[model samples]
Target: MNTSHQTATVSSKDGATPPAPRTRRRRNVAVVAALTGILGAMGTLVYFAVPLYQLFCQVTGFGGTTQVAAKAPGAVPGRVVTVRFDTNVARDMPWQFSPPAPVEVRLGEERLVAFAAQNTGNEPMLGTATFNVTPFKVARYFNKIECFCFTEQLLMPGERKEFPVTFFVDPAIADDPNAGDVTAITLSYTFYNKGAAALDEYLNRSRATAGRAVPREMNQ
Candidate 1:
């Protein structure tokens, strides 16, 4: 009887120990799964953070990003400020670019500025422009109504085209203490070739159109 009791007790203890390891394994698996889910979520957020931040800057004019407006500021101020224009082109882009000399205008007064571009390349090309305003702090107050930077430009070889930018400084800028010392603002632009894909698409369309058209001799 004593031997039987001892065997029974040992059997009970062995059975209890087996369940404990299984429970521990289950807990460990749950922890690993939870950690993996958290890391994946973080990676997704990081991927989307950049474009979201840029949109926020463009909308709020934070970080010296300028604003786009449909119309000029309604009120004009007596204060006069000088606006200087700057232009640049990428080394790979075969184009001559020029900006007009500086001009002075009253705050909230609309001014139209022109930039000239000529294609020096032997082939027709498409280009796009990017622009920004400086004294970075003044970007929020510098408003552009219309600008060529809004569109892509196509120029044939030896072709020259003039682009215009209409803009004004918000009269409310004077209310900001940080802008008190600001006297001059510079608008700068740089042009780059659009891309091979755009050029190829244009060429393909031209070829397709030519194929469908009847030659003048055939029509006659």
Candidate 2:
């Protein structure tokens, strides 16, 4: 009987696993899978971080970003506000951009502003403009009706063109406690070149044409 009991004890020690240990291992696996899935989702969010943030800013005017509207506000207010214009070009873009100076208008009144762009490059170039308002706190109250920024611009060598932007300050801005003290808003634009490939193609064509020119010996 003693020998039989000894054999049973050895069998239990060698062949039997505690149910609690098996359960703990399964729980650990589930937790690891859950963490992996959460990390994957986080990675996807990080991948689209820039564009998603931009869209959020556009929708909510979270930054100094302004709003785009289909029409002007319903009523023009008696309060007058000054809008100053500013312009810039990206370093690689071979174009000149200019916006008119300041103008004052009643709040909720639609105003038309023009900007001039000239392509000083030897080849055709394309550009896209982005704009923002200063004193970012009031940006949500600014609305754009028609803006050249909605489209890409293409200009030939030495070509100059004027682009128009129509916009207004929402009348509700006067009522907003945060924006009541604002008197002037600066509208700024920066143009980015969108035609690098076009410029390269133009250069290649010019080089090919030059290769066919009369040799110096022939001219002599």
Q: Point to the candidate with the largest TM-score.
A: 1
CA lDDT of each prediction against the hidden true structure: 0.88, 0.86
Find the number of clashing residue pairs for candidate 1: 0
Worst 10 residues of 2 by lDDT: 66-75
TM-score of each: 0.62, 0.58
Where model 1 places Cα greater than 4 Å from the true spot, the runs are: 1-67, 203-220
Clashing residue pairs for model 2: none
The Cα error of candidate 1 at residue 54, in Å, is: 18
User: What number of clashing residue pairs does each candidate have, in the order they appear?
Assistant: 0, 0
Q: What lDDT tens digits, residue by residue, belong to model 1 across residues 1-220?
A: 9999998799898885434878889999999999999999999989989998999999898998765687886547578889999999987899999998999989888899899999998988989999989999999899888888846788899999999888889998889999999999999999999877897787788788887785754788
The digit string of per-residue lDDT tens for model 2 on 114-200 reads: 999999988788788888998999988888888887367888899999998898888989889989889999999999987688557
